[model samples]
Target: MPFSVPPYRLSQAIRDKCKRLHVFVQAFTLPSCWYPHRIRILAPHPVRNKCGNAVRIKTPKTGSAVPTLADVARHANVSTATVSRCLNSPDQVVGETRKRVLKAVQDLGYAPNFSARALAAKRTKTIGAVIPTMDNSIFARGIQAFQEELGRHGFTLLIASSAYREDLEEEQIRTLAARGADALLLIGYHRNRAVYDMLTARNLPVLVAWAYHADAPQMSIGFDNVTAMAGLARLAIGKGHRRLGFISAPGATNDRARDRVAGVRRAMREAGLRDTDLSLVETQYGIETGEAAFREIMTSATPPTVVLCGNDVLAVGALRAAKEMGLRVPQDVSITGFDDIELAMLAEPPLTTVHVPHREMGRRAAGMLVQILTGQGRPDNVELKTDIRIRQTLGPPPPER
Candidate 1:
């Protein structure tokens, strides 16, 4: 009988390797030149296979056929079933037999098929993430922590960037799920209605990060955006910054940005300043945009004594604008930022910003997802503390003002 093949694409691990090799993949059958299975052709040149399904193609440089499970079974003088059990569930096989099968596996350089194992266990041990963007370092440290935690639990992570676009994010989410993600880690909770419904229907474990909404019915792991930034606002206000301005990434799709702005407004309102007294400039997330928005807010009939940025990326830009405009930070004007990323410290005058516990959040988020996946715990949210990092960028308003 002809060899049967499962449907759909190669696993993320295989595709990642293929990307580094710059190999082109196509649906084709194994040729007489190689094995008798259907596989994707990752050929520098080109070859064909009559097999109906797809597998990653990494032909040996020596032009030898890739080793298969049967090869290991033969080398160990055992049945394929024994080799399979030794690889997948060693406790089910005798110790001596397991050792023999493993040694054979090592000698033959055999890798148990990922798809086959996933099918048998109904778990891929793979986690997926769809982040807003990868261009900046804001999410880098946290994501690194998340990957490290997942690695410790013997899971692989695959990430896709959405560039802050909701439609693209939804697409990436579906693609990740279709590609065998056991659970997903997503940013704040402003997703489409159908998204949660779909994940629920599929019985996938999904966690929202970067914002904690305990009252909202979503599993999240992060600090409360409103309360965290409110603390910073109060600190800035306490320093005598009566004239305040806000430079933010677009709040249309981001509840985080909106919440931060709301926090500042709340502080001002409580301090007896009308919300209209505050200047709000919404821009894309970039250094250039930050500089331009800062200029616009500063050149007003009466400039703000301090400017609050939605996050560190914009704060970095505002700092640049301050220097270029011949204004000394915290002297001529105070500047505050959120998400105390690495750039916050690197600012000429180190930024006095809100310090988010990114690594801890990532680790906790991973632990929660793993618990849900492995049946050790149910879906839940974890609230982390956000600290006010007092540094050079925040001070009382100008002596004259």
Candidate 2:
């Protein structure tokens, strides 16, 4: 739960309270009895939360308590409704009166119940995202960017990982919707038709990310995966690395992985390489799985001159396996990856990979969803770009050993 509450939220809450306090002090003078030094804000007491709807404000320094809106009103020398207005809609209150109400709030440490405030608002100001996995750094930076932008707009972000399982994602989606999420963010457009239909039927807007297509249904905010990967494959081919091996995540559910593999195949075909020439292995999305697959490929009678991974995570695994086998990267066998995650840069050879604008994509996705919800824009797809960052991990095929 502590991890769920980011520092930005706490800072924002305090800053808002402080602004209100400054206004209250300027609006009018408070009697010495209501001075900040003598007053202390108390946590809500059960009696105040129960029958008769009493409010509780304890001043530990003075050994006294003032409970209820009536107490705040009396302390501020204003009507009860005025006290409410100052707390709820200070902008509508006369400056001096608003300041007076804020002073009372600060002096007594009067904080309203969260559930009561939500009921009055009629909307929860929360957005939910169901990503594939949260344990890795692949989505961490991007999700953090999205959350910070959402915070700027006074909205909370709730995240749940489906662990690459659609059934779990569907369940989480329903739960978040039931909990009153105004919008949803999904990964890729490969989900079941029924899931799409459900959101359509309920009129809930969803924006898909991490992969994009021109014609397929949902709105997208990501780069063209096939094209991005194809570019890198062509470059590898141009470097004269004829033999190739592909390490990928399961293609059954991952459009991104499928696209990358397709891109490599297309490149190989264009170079007159037969289908059987390139060894392809689909593995789980983990470093250890990647290492195993890498080792498996390397042991073949005619090992590949290069290995192309579906993502940086897999490439890093391949690199590790290469190291353990006493193989030199780019010299003994070249390797490349996609996603350009932070781990890519930290790799020993500094991975030569495709750099997707993850943070930029995240910020844009949140903005577009907000625009659609506010009726300012339609759910249109926005495609971003990717760059091929050639680095130490890739090079021309080595001379025969």
Candidate 3:
């Protein structure tokens, strides 16, 4: 036999320095180079630099090698069966043997092969998430909570962003599904039909978030978009704001935006204000867009006394625009926003917006997914509550108005 060391030999506790060094080189050949300090590599089969003289080249081990169970058993002076028990069911092994075996394995640079374990167990305990965008703090906060909860259940999370694009979101879904994700999480219900079909065909357990509807085709774990936004609009209306300027995201493609716009319209309708009485400006959801939309809304024949933004990002820009235009917030023009993000409170006047329970929703979503994955239970639509955060940002119409 070619002087080849067994895979398990490297994992044995090598008291002999020569044997340890020999096992190190034989175990790892060329691929394992991640932790350079852990192992040394020497030029194997070194030949003489000059004429016919034969010289032996030391083979250096540069990384941790694959250490089998037998290697650990021999190193620890225990039977292979005992080593197996220590790894598979440690409670059956005595304390002294377990400790010695573990220490020996550590000294011999031994690590369990997770891939083989995964194959045997038939489970990866991983969840995947596909969001429209991570640029928004709302998504980021929710995902952080989601991952935290998953960690408690001994599961890992893989996340990807799609930049609010339907096609890219679909692609992420396919990629995650192919990566052996036990469960999947998505931002919203709106997506390509093909993607939905693929998920259904593969029988992947998917949870949709952000906006929830009872009749939605997919499972959801989110608040009712129409109701949440409606509550905010109602709060704005209760403040005696009759003339309104709505700075909303373009509703043509985004169902969430459409629902928010609908909520605003419903509030205006209840107040006996016709559609003509409200000035609506559709723009991208950004600070720059907010500023431009606010300026445009103010240019109306009869400028509205209050401006309601789609979200906090736009509200911040709107507030800046008001100051630039010599208008004091609440006194010159009342401003209201949605999604009470961190920036909402930091604005000149703390934002009067709807506080979304992002963390709670994320936790519940993760918990539900874990339950489903473990065959514990399935979750119904998780409707998280939202509250209207009344702040100094919104007040009665200006005295000038």
Give the top-scoring candidate (lDDT).
Answer: 1
- Scored by lDDT, model 3 comes in at 0.80
lDDT of 3 at 9: 52
Candidate 2: C-alpha RMSD to true structure equals: 15.7
lDDT at 149, model 1: 82
Better of 1 and 2 by lDDT: 1
lDDT (0-100) at residue 18 of candidate 1? 47
* Model 2 lDDT at residue 96: 92
Per-model TM values vs. the true structure: 0.76, 0.74, 0.75
Poorest lDDT segment (10 consecutive residues) of candidate 2: 38-47
Looking at candidate 1, the ten consecutive residues that score lowest on lDDT are: 36-45
Local distance difference test, each candidate: 0.84, 0.82, 0.80
For model 1 the TM-score comes to: 0.76
Question: Per-residue CA lDDT of candidate 1, range 320-356, in tens?
Answer: 9999999998889999889888889888899999999
In terms of lDDT, the poorest run of 10 residues in model 3 is 37-46
Residue 380 of model 3 has an lDDT of 82
Stretches of candidate 1 exceeding 4 Å from the true structure: 1-107
